[model samples]
Target chain A: MGFFDKLKEKLTKTKQTIIEKIEAIVPVGKKIDETTIEEIEEILISSDVGIKATEQITELLKKRVKEGALKDYNDLKLLLRDELYKILEDNTSLNLSNKPSVILVVGVNGVGKTTTIGKLGHKFVSKGKSVVFAASDTFRAAAIEQLEIWANRVGADLIKHKSGADPAAVAFDALEHAKSKNKDIVIVDTAGRLHTKFPLMEELKKISRVMKKSIPESPHETLLILDATTGQNAIRQAALFNEALGLTGIVVTKLDGTAKGGVIFAVKKEIGIPIKLIGIGEGVDDLKEFNPKEFVDALFD
Target chain B: MFEALSDKLEAIFKKLKGKGILKEEDVDVALKEIRIALLEADVNFKVVKSFIDRVRQKSIGKEILESLSPAQQVIKIVYDELCELLGGSSAKIQLSPNPPTVIMMVGLHGSGKTTTSAKLARIFKKEGRRPMLVAADLQRPAAIEQLITLGKQIDVPVFHSFDLKDPRKLCQEALKKAKIDRMDPVIVDTAGRMHVDEELMQELQYVKEILNPNEVLFVADAMTGQDAVNIAKSFNDKIGIDGIILTKMDGDARGGAALSIKEVTGKPIKLIGVGEKLDALEEFYPDRIAKRILGMGDVLSLIEQAQKAFDQKEAEKLKEKIEKEDFTFDDLKEQIRKMRKMGPLENILSMLPGANKLLKDIKIDEKEFVKVEAIINSMTLEERKNPKIINASRRIRIAKGSGTTVTDVNRLIKQFNEMKKMMKKFKHGKGFKLPKIFPF
Candidate 1:
């Protein structure tokens, strides 16, 4: 199946919960009234679209209502989709202009950073681009071994150190290996840490800084991996990680589950960070390039 | 991030403060703001709607509207409603009357089940129970190894078999071994899966039936958004969870999922994972969490932690010394050491009411405590007891010994004298008060 179709199927549960609820709230042939708008607002908030983004969308709809541009439920639905798409629209492609583009993956623990790295490496390796995996997540037990498995599967060289070694050293070595091997991409997988931990955040900054020693202006893409099920804290994660590392993009994972990944709407609206990828399932091929059009379609259609 | 909801509420109520009485319109306005704040905290809209309705009903009552400090009344109503929705109090895990009570951990992937299982085992082991950990999560790569590693760290035995691909069989064997080893409270760490995955859910059901766990805890991320209701409901319906364990409470997330899960599943949150350490798991207290959400501060938790760190005999000894006006740098150093044992100084301060707002712009440098300890360690016993003996040259020598500046040593001596003066006043039957020690 095509990526869109797969996304639609993976998001089928989310659609059934959110889209069906929206449809039920705003039925056909019903006039869009203030009560209907309020119900739609509840649906958006319940879907985790967040208060600010939901207000932005509803405010637009209210304006349309005032202008008499919004006539029916279908129009409101389309308008909502359009607004979400606009917020989500950005440069959703990875920056690989350099010969050995470095992608630093960071997030809180248990957000599927390692698995996403594996899938991401598979994507690049399958495109005939040599890749190098940096197992810089020296904190978690067996995290390196997990990434090593992914590297072997994706046919990418992995640079790792002992479990308690410095993560910056691991990233430094990976960059050196990538340069020597002339690899197309180097993905650095850092241990998952809560953004609230100042020391850990400092460590991530150090890793980013050390990469520049090997390649000036290295770590071309700093992606924060966010769990779809995560709530408002995702915004804090994005804001802090962006402030710390100048995060280039975000990768929303576990969309195959019931979570609509609705927090991304708030993340996009608040942080203005483009989502480069969406991980739909556990398979290596489940990772897909994020397309706002297809993503909105999967939600509304 | 956890302070956001309370901060917003505090802002709203600031306008209502000092008002003589609350009108119906005032209650409506307050409820509207509360609704938005709760929604922003990621509480489910339906839950927020009902919660607001209840709060409004109470706030609109004549007794509440006519009460003195109507704003405080409204806050109390909201806190009570929140506490009601969050459950009455903290609930403990129900150990079966029969030996070998089984606990099965289930949740969506990456919810910290494996780590939590180990933490739970450590807790039980500490309580003098032979708790065995079962690595039933055969889905995720290296998950078993991860559990084994954690088990090893805690010195707890973990049950795993490579030949047993089926989790049902794996769990069955693990239970048999637990019984044989006389391990009570066997914890089975199941693979994290989507709640909608029928095959995986069915597999969990099979294992649940086989083991007949005494407590099926639904582990969830405390940062989970509005989807918490659906996920919690699905797990409760699919495998019938007995309780919940919210992880990553150390994050700034306001943890509205705790409220949502409780509302939907009618299950109590038995525990919370506060940090990454193996012993960071803590018993869930709904009232304390409610206070935290309202920014009223978690004084009870703070007191509990303080009591654990401060020995009663030592405290009495120090009190007697203070009453006799013998407060010295050595005693201050000992008190600081005891306070340090209660965890991070910032965390301890954050537990005080209105401290979040107070400390928002101020960063508490814990290094100051280290510097104080070093300075105290450098002081001679005679010099510590008699600050008058520390001449200018003695200060310089002590500063060099402690690797601090002479100015720092002078400041410490001055602060110590001022603290002694304050204790002298308290010894005269005046109210006791702690003097500000940190420069910040």
Candidate 2:
């Protein structure tokens, strides 16, 4: 562990120590006081639970306090765990929709849309399904070429166009080919245009429309890919895209590189979107389907 | 009252003013906040972790200035470190001591290489150089057209072979055209793949060998975040890079790639695209960015951007209003709108030289400003000009009118009063003299 990592590890350890300290205090069967509440709030915030979510959790705890549930520290701990688990558990499982599942990966530029698609393709292809990639981000330099490279690496067929071609047209062609080829699944990669950029975002909407033109309920899942290093902003981006595109799931990339992995919990709580996959490394095999239990366990451990 | 973050940072640094004894714990606490804020802003965690550690080592037990608080000392350390992380100092594209310096643009698709190239060409033109663009990205249908369009818009010459099958040959021919046309600085725009494919790498290598360009810049979009960092590393490792051009600096990106790329790949960021406009290209200056990260405020970037976006005549008119102390709600609203165009509230504030430390803890919500704006817009001109006219009844009416509660209306009025009072103080004094990390 280098300087920053050691410091972070120490900081996190301090946080854990604080949590353990708090955990011990709760078990002492003392009434929860203002100091205790403040400590809990600090703990939550330090854990990157986010100010909003921490406030909500505090409010919920306050309500229990108001109800004359004069609980001691153990009861408080149980209450805290139960409330956190409730908020975090609902979106735990990755939902891979019915056969020939269409996972439409979306994000702003550089969130690893192409890489995520490649990893997802490898995951699906390895599971005995014929996967095809549609390179729909034709606006950026070499976007199509990048997708083709991923497609080749994963041993999946790719539908590509010349750079600056219509992304929606490419999606149209991919869906048509997928249907005809009887492909098990199709993963369409779209450009990460700013959600505020109406024209570029409108182009994405057009791609969704074109895909539906081929398979009425085609894009079975819209996974918003976020860079895990972005922390809360990743949550904001997910919210914006969800508002714009009604995302079905999320894929948080660069987990191995960032200490802001606390964002995974925050995103799950805030957006209520299942983290379908995570990109831990750059290799095709680096992506793993999000297992919430494993994630939480790794975090606490 | 505006809580521009710049103001809050000014307050923090003010407390630290002139007392430069930085203890390890002082650095630790300050770095804790800085780390969290950067991570919150979406900066890479590893980058933040390493950054804080470096600051810790350099800052611990340091006592270099009198009358300076540990906080200010720590801020100074972090500020300098951030500048260092961003590429020690600003590095310009070597103008080819000879005319027609060759620059090759490379990066994955959607990395904004093409747009950045055009922006760079425009920058060169401003520097009084004849810039010629080569449409070497022939794989894409409109890639060439995009370059040509940008060239036309900027009035720079673009060379292309729409029917060319080989990009290598096209680059050679474009170089020849540049020499013949006496266009000393030639920028060749190449194609990008999704990932680093061998064929594309070889193609890039071939182009580099044939052109023997002075600068090979990898144009990575800041919005791509970590992926751009990875791509830059791969491209640098595979094809070798002189520098990096981070596009989409205007996007709601936490800007980790800007801090991480230089450290990871050892390539200085040559240029950055702050906006979609052809003239939005800026020379990458690491020190200014570092100060911003430490909450010292990036006044230089803010000034540069303001200068670019400011209409001098309009600015003079605003200055006159400020001089007269007649700044109205309408003007306030207009400034808010213009500031939005600059970037997020926190982002813009951090870029000001020493403003970051002042605004450390202040949270300025974009939506809250929108609410305040709505309340202001709902008022009639007379009502806007005369605050006394807003009685309790009028407050209620305005609240209902603006889809807010009377409390919200009252809050806006109260906040606006505080803001105007602060502005008056600023007008009289040195306008909140924030401590400079470096004497201007």
Candidate 3:
């Protein structure tokens, strides 16, 4: 089991225990009292679902029961799942509709943002798509070299600027080259941002805005890469990034290593963003599309 | 435990804290520190660049000069941002709809794939499901036997294909057996390659094609840190894995692997293996993990551990006796036995979150407990119930019987008295703190 799976497993266990307890309480259409409702809330919170989300869920459950929609525990569970699913149902696909689709990836330090971009490029190239990668994360000494190595392995074209070059300038160059080369995809690996820093978030925003000027609504997807092992903190990152850059979709990595993977449910439940891809392993082929039903099933199963 | 990282943070914060507004020069200096920190923590260089860039943009504003403690403020901002980039929220495992769900485990050799498979089996079993283990890792000699050994230890059934030549055949037969046995879940532990070998990749691909597993989990080691991300990327690109399982988390405090892999490979980490013990696997709780990284003591975890160890009935009975002010040495002996059953004293201490710093140098070995137990055992039954009976003359005799010095016996009695007094004070709503340096 991976870390994300471990996280998810804990979450699933909590979900199951709560559902089972609720099931036992509302057997055969019996009305539940305040005590039972309170117990359910405690279960949700103990499962690390966050106090706010738990309160919100219980409130929703209370409303349903009052409206006579939830006749029993089973009915309440289904309703809860549906409500949780609704919070998770923002279906933001990886803007693949664009010709030469340009995706600008961003995250904070050590969030694997650049590597995710490299993985995306590798994925596209494996599908026989023409891919070009720009080393826009130029501050670090070995970053350009690292992307170059990945590009070589995946057999994709790559562009890089001198170390310490303006990242935006590098991105502009990559887009211009991508336009002339008829590349099917131009994945610009940008500098990771500190979402807490207005200036850092602003730089990311500026990069997105600049890309739009060059490619006319370019950076078709602002994919925010998050480490699944981060648990609830991943949510804070998403909120900060979404507020600043209008993150179109999310790419959750390292799900193979964590049980907190249940955080996806909480995140999608709270953030209302679509998870485009999940990283399952270190192999190039480990990335998979976010099939919500499949995901939920794997979690419960 | 996280000394490697804390040292780096201390150095960076030390320099940053001494400054006012962060200038281009300051950014360069800070970036250098971050670059070194990430490298030391084993964060991939590519990942570090974007991270620093993001932080620089946020820290380079006039807001720094406007702040009272700009360095601390900036550090706080970076910490929060770091938390966000790791993942805004946790990713969960996707369960299959149908019964007899198949979960395929894959990873590099020595990544603890087989062990993690067994741990998952135990988890599912405790959840009241019949989980069958399929020893699909046929490449290594005794791999099947290893899985079988773990299965027997956990009391879960293992399906092996010793007669089968190919791994895919083993998986097919295993899944078939799983369905026949009515096992609600099946875990197929696949063989790992030395690196990213073609034959192993083909074998994994073949197994996936045959099993059509509900979940394909990639097991990894946290000590590898950033390299694990690249490894995940390579595996995902080839096999299309579903989730991740990181092992050896109990060993590394920096937990950079937890930070980098998710963003690098685009996978949800589902489980974490804390130790080498059979029951060491734990559900990944991000908030608790973050709190641990920040060196905040986890009180809830301590309470949970105590709950697991102390029987409620026994605890209630003991509390009643203590309430009556009838605490005895026998009770202390029972508590010591309970602690032994709870496993290593160091493990309990380390899990206390911020207790790491306090207990870092205190070596609480079994010998210490043994000495205390010997002193009590040498006492008469009446003396055991009431240590006040063991006065100087009685203590001398008891010390002779236990093969210890009279002073040793006297020290034990003194410690017991202090502990009793502290308990009494706590019961009476008085503040009673344990001595900073326990004599024993």
- Model number with the top DockQ: 1
- lDDT digits (tens) for residues A75-148 of candidate 1: 98788888988998865598999989999999999999999999999998899999999999999888988899
Better of 1 and 2 by DockQ: 1
lDDT of 1 at A272: 92
Which candidate number would show the highest lDDT if scored against the true structure?
1
TM-score of chain B, candidates 1 onward in order: 0.89, 0.67, 0.83
* Candidate 1 lDDT by residue in tens digits, B1-440: 36778898888898788577888888888788888888888888889889988888788878685677899888898889889898888899999999899999999999999989999999999999998999999988888889999999998999998778999899888988988899888999999999988988998999999999999999999999999999999999999999999998877888889888899999999998887878778888888888888889999988998898888998899889987787888889988988887776667777788887876766566778999999999999999888999999999999999999999999998888888888888889788776767756
TM-score of chain A of each: 0.97, 0.81, 0.81
Model 1 chain B lDDT-worst window of ten: B358-367
Interface RMSD to the true structure, each candidate: 1.6, 8.3, 17.2
Model 2, range B89-126, lDDT digits (tens) per residue? Answer: 77877767776799999887657778888888887888
Model 3: per-residue lDDT, tens digit, A162-188? 867877878888888888988889888
Q: Give residue A67's lDDT in candidate 2 (0 to 100).
A: 85
Query: Which parts of model 2 are misplaced by more than 4 Å?
Result: A1-106, A110-192, A195-235, A243-245, A251-272, A275-301, B1-26, B29-53, B62-68, B126-129, B139-142, B148-157, B194-196, B223-231, B306-440
Query: Highest TM-score: which candidate?
Result: 1
Candidate 3 C-alpha lDDT tens digits along B1-440: 34455546666778877775666677678777776566445555457667888878777777776778877766766666666656655566566779888899988755678888898899789889899999887755457766877898899999997788798878878878888889968988888653346667887888899999888998876655334565788789989888888776654335566667777877777778765567767666555554454454445556776787798999999888778888788888788778765655555666675466566455454566777777788999999987877878898899988888898888877777777877788789787685221333
